[model samples]
Target: MTTELETQIAKYQKWRENLRVTLEAYQAWLEGHGHADIQRSLRIYDLVESLKSDRVILAFLGEFSRGKTELINAIFFSGYKQRLLPSDIGRTTMCPTEIFHDPSDEPYVRLLPIETRKSEESIGSLKDKPVEWVTIKLEVDSQEEMAKAMASLAEVKVVDVDEADKLNLLNDSEFVTTTVIKQSSGKVEIPCWRHALINFPHPLLKNGIVILDTPGLNALGTEPELTLSMIPSAHAVMFLLGLDSGVTKSDLEIWQQYIRDSVSRRIAVLNKVDLAWDELKDDAEINASVERQLDETATTLELSREHVIALSAQKALVARIRGDTALLAKSGIETFERMIADEIIPAKQQILRAAVAREIGGMLESSMASVRSQFEATTNELKSMSTLGDKNRDLAKKLLAKFEEDKARYGRHMESFNT
Candidate 1:
């Protein structure tokens, strides 16, 4: 029941893998031939491999309770109660969270606990916290299965693994006894509990796509993996908003200072439209008001009005899951979905996607020169009396075709996000 978008992403990933195998084969052949021309082909193959694994990471960032989770809901979920990011206002996600695909030869959400590390001997500890990192191996396949992995990360509590032995409740040696540990009258020391360790063999992410759902920038004392690793590596950033709140000074500050600085493409989304529109007249009027606000805000930021997408994350998430666009709009979700297509997805296409591009581009300029050189040599050869003209014509045709094909394939890899 996967949608066209999912299938398209799958196809592109498969194509990339096929190309990788082909390029590897070419490289192997070039090694056997040991000619200067063959070396050029090997280099071209290496370039293709780089392009295939050319990752485009998308990071979600905002303040607590800013509907960052709801925006994730709109993008990743597709059903009734389409809830991806936890939407609790009071308990607004306290830890760093992540949801991504992992297509290992043996796939599992290798949940690396904060205090532990995976090793052959045993779970080891780092800084007097507990033993080291041990991955919580969870098996999964489809999207629904992936949700379980995220939920497991959310549900688990942190306890001292050594303390678990005292309770005689030691089910697994790798299990760390989770606790809120010690509390100082005002300040408290709680045993750290992690959010999630999700891994899946999703077609989109395997070739190099990682989508992150963060609890804004203000979260404390949780895992540092998010800010240190994920954020810095992301190719794009999605900034969510609430329609009731609109664009605030804090939002502007974060955008101008942090998110905009790191990510080349930033998407500003207005969520919770259902609540805001309920207070307005007709749908058109509600939309008009949002447009007006979008313009005012974008102008202040010196960003294009198109950059601020007016959406109901709550609605779009539900609609996509139910495959009901009418219901999505009725629920105020259509706006989010449309915004994703118009702004975020297209930006991905323009930035990272190039069909046979990265490798070919590298080879295009370099290989063509060699091809021409070889062609001249053939023309000058006395043995080419009957074959010189044909060989030269063939090389010329191939050289022109290479670049021509690259230009035509510009957006093929982008089709996954294009919708």
Candidate 2:
């Protein structure tokens, strides 16, 4: 059974493959026709490699307890028949987590330690140096083992205020109130890892989909790399807001500071719509109430109503696990998935097309110009030789000499062009 998301990604992958083949054909054409050069060959090679490794990154952003992680599970991991990532009540995903499939590597979780924050190196630079991370192997065959390993994302360590301050984990105004726990021993609790990378072999991930689950504002505020680089680089971003809490001050702050202008394809997800379900009222009443909330949320976030999605991620996951069509339909998960398939993926494809054109369009134009010049020179040489038969002997000799000179110059120019 192919899903809409799977179908769309398959089409995307096929498009990329076709583009690769076209580039290869173009390379052959240039070489066969004597237009290939070192610089042009290198550019083509880099473009093909980039296309082979291209990924569509979807980032989920929100404050804590907004069901962001649960939404991720519902969308991508419902087949495991359990919650893949730790999505508990409050502050579940402590650090930024990136989930993707790297075919060259086995299934594993690479966690960067909190102590690494003391170093001057950013998380982006640390990814290249595997020695800085703690690697945990995952048993893909065992769901229980995989869950246990993934639970480490929520792991925390208690450190004194001084150590916490040194790690930049203690922000008196924001971190203490939102992300950390103050204990009787005068120690503060913080996330054990700075960032997490999970290389799992899921179908969507195998098809070049990267899922980025980010922590709340406290972590976002402290990690400048995430705000400055990662989030903005994602192809699309979904900002979750709970229906029960509406949009809090912290949520608004996160939107303004991190999400609002970072990505072009931004979605405001109104999660936990099941909370509005009432036994005493009919479905119409419940729907009206939900729509009213959605309108309010859209207005608050200053987004169009079409971009605001309302869904219950918990119910959707349960419906998927249980194979309940009714609950699944009511959960509105299918609608959201369709939007991603129909809107986001196509938009990303257009951006990629524009970028590729900008990179290779100039080289192609130059190659065509060189071919045109060579064709004109060859035509003139043939015309000169044909006219030699009707001229006097001396004139014919001069024409032949000029024709040979032109041919030799053309050969030299071609040699220079190829080299």
Candidate 3:
């Protein structure tokens, strides 16, 4: 049997690459034929690059241990044939993470120090300073080595209480007791990195799908960018909730604060549904109970039932790796995968196409207008010069004045562009 999941990703990537190639050609034409002014050309160039490198960023948001990372592992990294991102019990993804294809010299893990947050630089700017990042080289040939490298996401470093405050890692909340210490001496445990960027040659990511695996609300609260810029702009946001602990206080807070307003771009996942399933119980009864919880969650979050997906991410990962068709179907991942394939990805593609058309199309129109104006002015000058005597001299003077006027207009345009 063929995997529908693989085919969906392939189709999405095909559309994305086609658009990227067209944008690349458009950028080349603009550079070769368009205005030479640095500011004006650079503005168009930035948009073209954005169109070429654009990917559908799927932001997975939930509290700690809600199976956010596990769902990511099952949905994308299952090709590794083993657990790639650490999903073991008690392990938590402690920072905002971005996973995408690097297409560079090698696959590696780059971590930003938590201390860098004190600087004025944005996260995007800090990415250029490789020295400030703790880099880990990845071995693509061995799944075992890759798995080991993946575990670095869970690594943490202990520091004195004072140091944690200096890094702005300390926050007052009931759910934030984990970072505090009650020992005789003042000490605190905190994640060493503020963010992690994993650039791997994963098939899906290489085709243009970026996954943002975020930590709990406590961690997310500290990073304003996640709420203001990242999550708001994602193609889709999956908010995972534990089956046993449906819509807890912390989970609801994250949803209301960040995910609620973007209902059209969000999916509420009831993860670890296997824990609620039983062999002795009738299959119908088990399903009924799960449905009840799903309804309750949907009501609480004010989302439609279709937006809530109940799935066992762990089972799905295992089923995919072992090729267990029965378990795979039971895992509920197929339904979720279909939604992303048929709806989410295609919707994101339409948005990208519209953006390119709006920006690039505008620039093309502006360039054509400039050319048309120059042509008309030259044609008028030629007609006037054809007449004899004083007409020719008067036309020459008028042509010189026209030339000055055009130059001044062009200068004004360039001046506004520089600002």
Clashing pairs in 2: none
Candidate 3 residues lying further than 4 Å off, grouped into runs, are 1-5, 20-47, 173-184, 262-264, 360-419
Ranking 2 against 3 by TM-score, winner: 2
Compare the candidates by lDDT and give the number of the best one: 2
lDDT of 3 by residue, 129-171 (tens): 8888998898988888888878878777777887777776677
User: Roughly what TM-score does model 2 have, to 2 decimal places?
Assistant: 0.89
RMSD of 1: 10.6
Task: Name the candidate that leads on TM-score.
Answer: 2
Q: Ranking under TM-score, best-scoring first?
A: 2, 3, 1
Candidate 2 lDDT over 202-269, as tens digits, reads 88899899999988877788888898999999999999999888889989999998988888888999
TM-scores for every predicted model: 0.66, 0.89, 0.80
Residue 21 lDDT in candidate 2: 86
Encode model 1's per-residue lDDT on 1-419: one tens digit a residue: 45444555555556556767765654554344343375576566566657565655677777657777766666555432446445666335444555566454355543344333222222122322322333455544345554554454333344554443343323342223122333334332332333343454555556455666665433421234455546667766777766677668766765765666666676676666677565548868877877777777677656667677666666666677677768665664444445544555555555544655654556545434544565455434424343446668766566446544543343331231122
Regions of candidate 1 where Cα sits further than 4 Å from its true position: 1-22, 25-29, 36-49, 79-85, 105-131, 139-149, 152-191, 194-196, 220-229, 321-323, 330-419
